[model samples]
Target: MEIDAIATAHAKRLSVADALLPTPPNWDAAAGTELSVRDGVALATRSRVDAGSPEALWRPLTEYRLNVRLGGADPGAAFGALLTEWDQLLEESEASDWDSAAVVTRPSRDTVGTSELLRRGFAPTRVLAVRPADRLAGGPPEVPGVRIRHAEPSELNTLVRLQLELRNYDEQFGVLTRRTDEERALTSATRELLADADSALPSLWIAELYGKPLGFVQVEVPPAAGWADSYVAAGSAGYLASMHVAEEARSSGVGSALAAHAHQLFDEAGMQAVLLHHTLANPRSTPFWYAQGYRPLWTSWYRRPAVQG
Candidate 1:
């Protein structure tokens, strides 16, 4: 198909989808500004890296993202054509030594894109969730000897250690990809937080028992360009960037206490909702986040190793 025709079709499909969304995305602008022809289909690509890691040897990654509208006169055929083109692109990427690729879509009960991705070996890797800040206003559950407080600058090393523990837990479920010089990466992240005084980076909360930190939760204002921001009204969203509780502290209310404290912070800041992403493959994360009042808004579909065929 011609590139102009493909772009027009994709734009129409996106407009239909956007009208159904709980919060309409700026698809018109995105289609006009970022749309391009690839393998005879309209699409876009973005290159990214695990910049938080300190390792120098790791390579950058690329995402061959498609924002095309799926349905048409013959929806199945249209989807099949796009998938065939995508497979060709993937083969080219493997030959070029690309490390990985990914796609993001709004969660839907059934769609041509979702079905085709599943048949092509893609799997759901992450789920983005959102909840109103007012829903988070209840007092934190109490646990004896457990207290939640802002992390002190003197305890930077301790915070890093706790984050490393969280990383270890996430690694088990393939949630984390970048693994290089963790201490250095974590130290850099901590320093960045400290340097951003106007933001909530300093609002890192520690769940402690007798002056020893057992778990932590970090909240921050979402970036203007983030996917979550599209769904949130201006100045009404906070990102729950990270939350972790020690294994021994699990089911003991430490996690709840930390979450409650985070809610309090967002509430005080006048945020109307909180947004976060978690790996669906993690057994612990799915149920826990649901219990905390989060619901999925978007799903990330992925394929790893970028193998050539």
Candidate 2:
């Protein structure tokens, strides 16, 4: 592996991209089966992620990933060649309809190669959005007859159902790929976590109307934000892990109220920013999140089954 070369290339790209991407991770121990393109002018890795893995529960049944390192010269050409090779491999592999080929890249400078990606049927389906923390903090948005409060331990079933509904809605955009048993596994995990007396859970709140829970949002603050703390360029960050609104309650101000509440909490926690992932194809959420002060920090490109080309 040309670790130094790859790192230097990536750092150079980010430095000139004019985006808010964070420092690149060390390339020496990047996981996957390493491969080269254009005689190592470009590098990549292939990894087959199985659905049975714990992390894969929220991923596609199979993800034959070909992650690229277009850190070399003419990244546009490098990406094109690397993807062509990956497509050829997809043609020979036995794959399920649910399987997908995934690529995650910065949208600013990496847009140079994405035209080829789009031509081959890849979709920019997901975005990592960031909301800066210096904004004014206020109490929850007021909606007549609506109450916003922390979720009770007994509302576990309702909470799980709402989350599943969220996953179902997001999956239509081809981003939340997962197995039929995802709900089963997720429920068990949630149950175990809730039952643990010492477990530090994220702050979860529910919106209720007429005493019936109708929506919910979840947030993880610094020191416990897991991966989010490292993804930002500076200071502590908070993660808006998940949010969902009941179908019967869409456009009833439930979502906006929940978002305002979450922002207040994020501000109080002293977060430098709040991060989240949302499907770009969702007409409703795409604009809603934008109105809530979030903008794209990274766009994840994907082509399902890898055989579409």
Candidate 3:
């Protein structure tokens, strides 16, 4: 195990490139160690080396996985090297008393090389792609007695409540990714954003059927350069942060209505494209977005080894 800093400039570059690529444990950045496994697999496990108790390199791997958040690094060569090294190390380590081993990696075009890691000897794994949804060229369904309008300050709480219930976001990604206080803060922040007069900021759109709240969609304005740069650089445009519809209203064209309304807003604004990520693991969303005509631009995988495998 090599915990010390890498001497070679390229090795250091690998570390920086890894850092640049978005991973889960972002703010928890810390000093990392390069450890050797059974068959010469070199695993780079990181820890908050500056914290009070910085555990050993293999400690977290044994207990729980540290998620990788893909930022903007080209995983083509760096990730391939990481996987190859780890595979070699694992083969050598399997003969020892060690029960299991795993490595964090982003999925690439070469699915064959990735699958071989399991065939050759790695344990249980997964490949999840984060799919983005885009708007279609059309208008929403004309639900009788339903009208779309700009969200008002008075409807802020209602919007939050509807979003919590309709999207099941609170359970799906919110609770897992945010604390109770964080959720409350997010709700308030959205309301404040609605009241702001910044033209470059995102806008919140509301849908009402027979004077009742049907759903809402939020669109960030002026466009984000970091995330949408690739799509936008090639002439793609806009962003859809969050969209939700009431439970009873879903599948009744309300979701499409909200999306179409957003498309109208984008078209009016002269933007051509919109981008937003959805968890492929989510059942309701996978098909919903597909029906809306949004295709995947890229996919990110989450891999974990079984306890005994």
Candidate 4:
């Protein structure tokens, strides 16, 4: 139960996961090597769930995450032991106010951890994918009457409106559940992004046809220091934070044109890779991302309404 022992266990789990899908060149194993143990377990807090529901319904919610190493004698029992320990830790701490728990593992045709999670009421929710910037081919396609450009300061309101629309689209798939206040909070956050001159978090790109808005993409040059042992390569990644095309423009190649432009910018900036997350449940997302040359680096498995039985 020592931290060293837990780190070793986690390392083994990461190796197995990497082997399943192969970590991209931009990622470093050393990032995953650094770990701290609490209560005799190495735990990684993925995020706080604040999707906008009533505080009573979703407040105090978190996702407790871990990587399950499944390569020991009696692998089944070993995984079971880890799960038991995790459940016990939850029972013993106020931190367990979690509404759900999650884990990302390598995909294998057959893996004990995958089966165990499935049986224990968890489901795969999101996928994290990466593609090398150099892999982007050709130029941004030319669409009749379509123009792509970075957003000007005067267009912040339009960007916010587009984001709201994107949020609405995601809500249809049950991916976002923000309350009105939370939605307004998101708007405030986006506005701050627009106002910050020193911020490198995400740069907005707008696509217009005949001088009318059609879609937008948010891109960023990610700081290498922030991502340790993540699927992304440190210092060399340009992240596609978000992208959306209006419903009427979906089949008209606006998304592709915008993506191609984003890739071109990243390539010009000398980025080696691009990373993004998309929900697997959304039929429109999965195929579109894959077609753009992205492959899964990590898969998030979850169970919603994560209440303890």
Candidate 5:
């Protein structure tokens, strides 16, 4: 069929999967490779990202990103056929030998063709979670020894260190790559995020133990997080960018306290919902976040290097 009809059909499928799912409405189908079958249709785009690019910091060193659309009653079979074409397209691309990944994101509740995804060697590596406003309705419990307070711009290095520890922790899962200049990028990224501060909105909060900082949570509310507003169907949404605690502070209630601190700010800002990403394979993260009332809204499935079988 036509690309316009494909877009409309793809959107309808996602809406049925999860009504709250923030559908990405536009991708230039004319520029992508498309395959139409008797019962369904598939469209995908192949784009590469260089390691040195700022976007690569969150993804693999280099990435052959895939934006796939499989729409029909029989998405399972259609998706299986799409993967065959996906492989052929990669083989014809120049970066087939590059150190990168072929990644696709789908609504968390979309399960029709996931068996094909796994059989084709893809794994769900990341999750974008959603916590409705009601989750923050309850007050955060008091952690006796942990003091959660707003972080200062002067404490840039301190924030970066804690954030680095998080990245290092997530590395074991293979979703986050270690960059040569990670520290520099981490510092710059952190600095830029902190600079968008609002006098009335305390976006960053640090938790201290025995007068020593141990954990932090950086949250951006509406107006503060306007960039993320489009992702949610709610009146407004907040972003939980980063939250980390030192290794020594694990299981000491510091992280819990930090989340509570963030929830309080989200409540004050009149947020309708909050969005954040977490490594799906993380042993501790999934349970901890679920306890905080966050549930998966999107899942990012990937295979390292597009050539991987």
Candidate 6:
């Protein structure tokens, strides 16, 4: 397929993503074989495989998408280091005779290597933050009738409902309101990551008020490779992968409570700083994140309709 032909169309479809992140519509990665966008940065590359082992299927998910990892025969490859050098990889992919494939990265302050990727011409897609230590030191103000607890498997439906409701998407990517499939994906990814101690630790936290689930945040610790780095080893950082608060619960301190809980959990685990990502398209998240002590680390995204076609 001519990537250019799909570039604009892809961007339009991805516009929905902007609701959650500051992302573009499409990007040209492998000279012009494929298109990708994460937080508005689109990348193009040739398809690497039309069909492959489970591991191969997962490569794309983990390499460039936000969905959690999958279990079963899927490959659970780690892109931690590869992401730091994405531009170089893109160059190599372009030079190689291999089939093309595109990948995207969302906004996140923990992505310190993004600036380098931008210098290599990867493109800017989103704005994100790394929260400072002591940012969430104060205990959360009590929400009457609300209780914070470790979510049980039975609560997965409630958790997923709250997750989708907060996003205003009764469905995503054609999936129905019922998220048994998505929940499986999350569980599979979490399980795979956990079974492999070297992989990043995935912690899923949810908030409930009076038997009603409100919101949640899924935080992932650095993968094993990050453990050796002085920056990470020094108890310097924790990553907030995704956070959401339901509309009904917004302005009700549910978010702050969840955030404070995340902060405390990370702090107790020895992280001195907390990092996260936000979509520039979301007017509310940026300001709220800022108030919570986050700052931009780098910007990345693909070509949107707003940019030159």
Each candidate structure's TM-score, on Cα atoms with residue i matched to residue i, is 0.79, 0.85, 0.59, 0.76, 0.89, 0.52
How far does residue 135 in candidate 2 sit from its true spot (Å)? 2.3
Name the best candidate (by TM-score): 5
Query: Across residues 1-309, which tens digit of lDDT does each residue of candidate 1 receive?
Result: 565555465546545644323433335444322432332343545455554534321223545565554434555466656666666765655534434555645444325556777777777887777767678545777778899887777778878888888777776554364456767878887767655667644557789975678898888864632445565444568889889888877887888788888877777877777888888888987888889887776677766544434
Question: Which residue pairs collide in model 5, if any?
Answer: 100-305
Query: Scored by CA lDDT, what does every candidate get?
Result: 0.65, 0.73, 0.49, 0.63, 0.78, 0.48
Q: RMSD of candidate 4 to the true fold? A: 5.7
Give per-residue lDDT, candidate 4, residue 214. 80
RMSD values for the candidates in order, in angstroms, are 4.5, 3.1, 9.6, 5.7, 2.5, 14.1
Worst 10 residues of 2 by lDDT: 38-47
Record all residue pairs in model 4 with backbone atoms less than 3 Å apart, i.e. clashing. Answer: 26-233, 51-177, 51-178, 52-178, 52-179
- Once superposed on the true structure, which residue ranges of model 6 sit more than 4 Å away at CA? 1-124, 166-184, 190-202, 222-235, 304-309
Task: Please give the lDDT score for candidate 2.
Answer: 0.73
Candidate 5 lDDT by residue in tens digits, 100-167: 77777778887868998898788999998888886765677777788888787888899989988888
Q: What is the lDDT of residue 28 in candidate 6?
A: 27
lDDT of 4 by residue, 215-272 (tens): 9998877463235235554457777878999887888888888888888888887777
Clashes of 5: 1
Tens-digit lDDT track of model 2 for 150-256: 77778889988987888777778886775767777777766654565553544678899768899998888766685885566758888997888999988888899
In model 5, where do residues sit more than 4 Å from their true spots? 1-10, 94-98, 195-199
lDDT of 6: 0.48
lDDT digits (tens) for residues 52-90 of candidate 3: 221221122232222222111342333344565544544
Writing each residue's lDDT as its tens digit, candidate 6 over 1-309 gives 233433353334334423222233222244543222222222333333222333332222212222111112111122223333344445453333222223344433324344544543345445545665675646766777656665555666666565545435422211112333444555455445334434334366668867778887777555532532322223456788667877788887888777777777776667766667565556677788887777764344432211111
- In model 3, what is the error at residue 243, expressed in angstroms? 0.6
Which segments of candidate 3 are over 4 A away from where they belong? 1-81, 84-135, 166-175, 200-202, 224-226, 230-233, 304-309
